[model samples]
Target: MTQQTQEPTTAELSAGYAAGLDPREVAETILTRIAAREPVLNAFYLHDPAQVRTDAAASAARWAAGTQRSAYDGVPVTVKENIPRAGHPVPSGTAIANPPVAATNAPVTDRLLEAGMVILGSTTMPDWGMLSSGVSSLHGVSRNAWDPSLTTGGSSAGAGAAAAAGYGPLHVGTDIGGSIRLPGTWAGLATLKPSAGLVPLHAPYLGRVAGPLTRTIADSAALMSIISRPDARDYSTRPYPQMDWNKRLSSPRGLRVGLQLDAGSGAPVDPEVAAAVQLAAELFAAAGATVVPVAPFMSAAMLTGIDAFWRTRSWADYRALDEAAQASVLPYIARWCSAGKDSDGAATIENYQRFAQLQQVTRQATESLDLVLSPVAPMAAFGAEHPMPSNDPDEPMSHISFTLPYNMSGQPAATVNCGFTTDGRTIGLQVAGRTGADEDVLAACAWFEGVRGDAAPDWSLVP
Candidate 1:
């Protein structure tokens, strides 16, 4: 039996854990975490134990060479199946690996490898990352660490569980809706949705790439530094800066937080969630930040359309990638390929135009607001059987009302634990920045990590 020894954290392990606290040793810890919890949590869709060991061995060698890429070197991190993982089956966790191990890694993976992060394996995801409930027909459901009975949110289920279980210090997951944010919040970890172009998706889900299942904001930023670059292969990179994120100052030199007063929708937040947001507001104010109200809440109508757009657009594309490619996927996936197929071309065109208009509106309103803050999901983790609550959030039609718009606008976003409910469920505070404001968003996230109630992961209660 692997005795859990308050296992050294990402930071501590970087300094000591694996063979001499080497990353490979840290990889062993991840393998251990998976072995102990996988039977119950079922977080991974497909993890290659052999690869993990081989990578760990290399990680040890890197450490021995006094050239571990970064302190993160050797840490076996999980990747959501949606994003490309060069050569690995990225059927988004439908039917094992999709793109044959011969494919090249996603830019993020290249960055992860460059940063010395050992690729543990792919994590579970809803078919195509289209669903928000986190349960996949392929891997089943990813349970919340706080309460195994509830959802750890979705699309990044494996990423969230791996982090919550201390599988590794970080993870990589993309989010068009709340895929990244919801998982991190539900799993009680920090997550960031880089401005659309910051970390180019390269292939599918190319428009939005958010960091998920990370233990701390620093690792997320560090990962960003490695991956965010001008990749000629990715056209989206043209709009983002090619500058190095390592050049970014982690310090929040007195932030200007724009508080979303109503959070619009009259969507009543759980008292605990509300308290967490309020507490976060107070902390930001205390930390030399001037908090003020900001705008850009989606009208009730726009809320419903957001999820509709993501599902229809994502599935329609998933449907195109050749039969042989698609066959490797799950049946439920083929089912969701057109849930929103009825979305008229006119509606899509109009909605597409709305995205541009939304951007301008955000510019006018947020030109002066440094970072905007709100409840990550407006709720706590839910039951595992149903990725969502049996009873919907106030807006029953829009499960992802809070997160999708940002993805639509291509802005950077992040969720950090602010407080816990009386029932002990974790709540997250999301902070987003205007376009091209990734560094600013990261700076703000680092602030939250330092001050807000580190509500993520009650390891003491980890099942």
Candidate 2:
């Protein structure tokens, strides 16, 4: 079989099984790819070949017996390091030694396993999922597949790199502040940040959900179908019974898509980036969707307030650690903690107040629209070693202006590769929908993907 045909997607793998491709062979091919490319990308945090082989063998038997588990049977997938898997260490990408192993699989992990998917390993993230760039103290850095000098945006860093590099067809990553979408955009992949509680998150918190990063939207929808189910452990999880996410993809005719170029932050967007987003809007228009340009709804105060709230949480977690452990953290993370250490209870309350204001503005701006589209990040991928594109001390949150608002308002958002820069960097278009409109957000993304054909960069050309 050709190399391209060897790495089948979730649906392709299932169909290939019936056509006489053994699950064990597919599993071995994935393992071999991981071994060859992982060193360059730093994608896997903990990959066990033996365990993956065992799981593949079991899936093979099940297929042979006509008792296949689910549509993802034998499909290889990687989970983020912060996500727990039974007996695997949940490091959260830190320098702490001997991190405790999880006693049980996280709800998402359990659901994927139940569907007969092969767990390739855990992917790396920034320390405690704090940074947009994937420069972690524990596992080093995850390089972008298109350009290694540029970052694979984090905290879902490794998953993005793995997806772009074709390590596998499906990768799970969590997003709080553009983690999944940022990486997805930088690496030229499709990713989703589902509506809050649509995908059950253990230890519920604001602005966080586990979602998939894949080369194709159908694979993402397939993974969503399995992981979006209600888990009793996550009290905030909403019931998602019998939802066929894959079938939701259709021509987006008559969909009112509002295009916002800036988030009112005055952050300069790259000219190429702006053009790519406009081109995406044009694509939607051609697909029979009305593309309307809308004013930026997010303000400076709103962005700063959201940054402060998350930084405060990071500060609290940092303070709970021993002094030496805190010192061992990445300097950027340390600075993040130190900056928010002075925040009082009133500051947190004020942050929430600002959140409410932003939520209201978002609702008002998107009220008459079916979906809102924008650039995923203000620019293409930047230096892998730096925290942000700029070196200015006060500009840490500038890049995330487009993505953070959705996290605050609990809206479902997704990012798809729209086009490429002159130098070959990928550009992403963000599609966000109403609070409970997760399916619509994904459908719009699927439609965009269909119009764009396949935009993924040639990973084999990357050094």
Candidate 3:
């Protein structure tokens, strides 16, 4: 009745058996939960019931043979529609690719499959992973299970929503520009945007990397272990760290934590979001992580430049299509794509310089710290009716401000639920790491989750 208290899947199972719940039963229970929630939440692009059974059966067999695939074996997992899965469509939420057929599973996706995580099907993303808010003109909008009117942050919108709603115990998503972190934050889930290139992007666009969204930090780490494997199929993947990611680590306190609360947008981040971030900074300091407040978050010019480069991407590619093909895309995606086609390279160049500048500054600023913490968004998820902004792609676009810097800097960044807005929308606290300090980011985030006591935000108890 009251949702089987959510079972430990994959990595979660190793630390301890979860109330005697077997991985097989966990998969079945999650499928049942998905059936009950998907109609209202619409979290998945499509799921093959038979495939779930086949994968689960294989995982159970592995478990019986004493050779269960890592922690996630048998876990029901969902991937972002934008990530190519062999023989499936990776639409990027576009009408042009409505069928989203993929010739091969993305390297990151392949890693998950190799680990024995069963795919529940694909979740939605903004058209071409463009929109800042979850509202994709293509697949309609992925509602925030926490607050339907608001959003399930995106371009990993449905990925976050699905995880939040208990559709899958684990979710995989791409984050070129907060695709993973944003939706996870909005949906009150835990997510990581590994340093650019940490995970491979075998799909057409090369900048994005795959990361996981989940109910627990351990689940996220487990998913990462599967997805982070360097693959010969994709040249883009980095070699796996020589160290074991599963090893237990020490607390983050006593570690220097830089706080970056502002961005180049020059617009004020919501006060509530700010307070929540400060609370996080304070928590780190109190717990022994040295928290330093950094001033004048990235400049407005830098902010605008970063915003344009990341936001304009989906559209830049969109212009190559004919009118009818364009029309076939989501309304908002079409609108956004239209805007990008006209914007001169100057738009991208400005973003490029800002990116270089930010990387320089980010490196300089954080040289003293182990990590930087900040707000995920200025505002909480707005109702579905609220028109998601598609302002000029050139100047600092508003929503992407809080989340896209990492995409530009190619650094690891994470979003953990910090606080909820007065309206009940969730506020996300982002923690970014020095270039390639991804596991550290996850370790710190997991430590925070352990202290926080909540995995995904329990909306009913948010207040």
Number of the top candidate by TM-score? 2
Off by over 4 Å in 2: 1-6, 240-242, 248-250, 391-394, 453-463
Query: Order of candidates by TM-score, top first?
Result: 2, 3, 1
> Which should have the higher TM-score, number 1 or number 3?
3
Report the C-alpha lDDT of model 3 over 1-463, residue by residue, as the tens digit: 2343544555555433223436566667777877766666667887887778778778777777778766556767888887777777666776674454788777767777777778889888766676665666566767767656667777788888887877666798887666788776677777888876667667524347788898766777777777776766656556645535564546775788888777656456878888878877777887887778766546677765555565567666666778777777766556544555555778677666777787666666667778889887776676654335434433345766656667766778887887777766677889888767878888888778766653236633421
Per-candidate total of colliding backbone pairs: 21, 0, 25
Per-residue lDDT, model 2, residue 89, is 91
CA lDDT, every model vs. true structure: 0.68, 0.84, 0.70
Model 3 error, position 88 (Å): 1.5
Distance from true location, Cα of 257 in model 3, Å: 1.3
Name model 3 segments beyond 4 Å from true.
1-4, 12-24, 97-100, 204-207, 247-250, 306-316, 344-351, 385-396, 453-456, 459-463
Please identify which of the two predictions, 1 or 2, would achieve the higher TM-score against the true structure. Answer: 2
TM-score of the candidate numbered 3?
0.89
> What CA root-mean-square deviation does each model show from the true structure?
3.8, 2.2, 3.1
Please give the lDDT score for candidate 1: 0.68
lDDT of 2 by residue, 74-135 (tens): 88899998889988899898887778799998999999888988989999998888888888
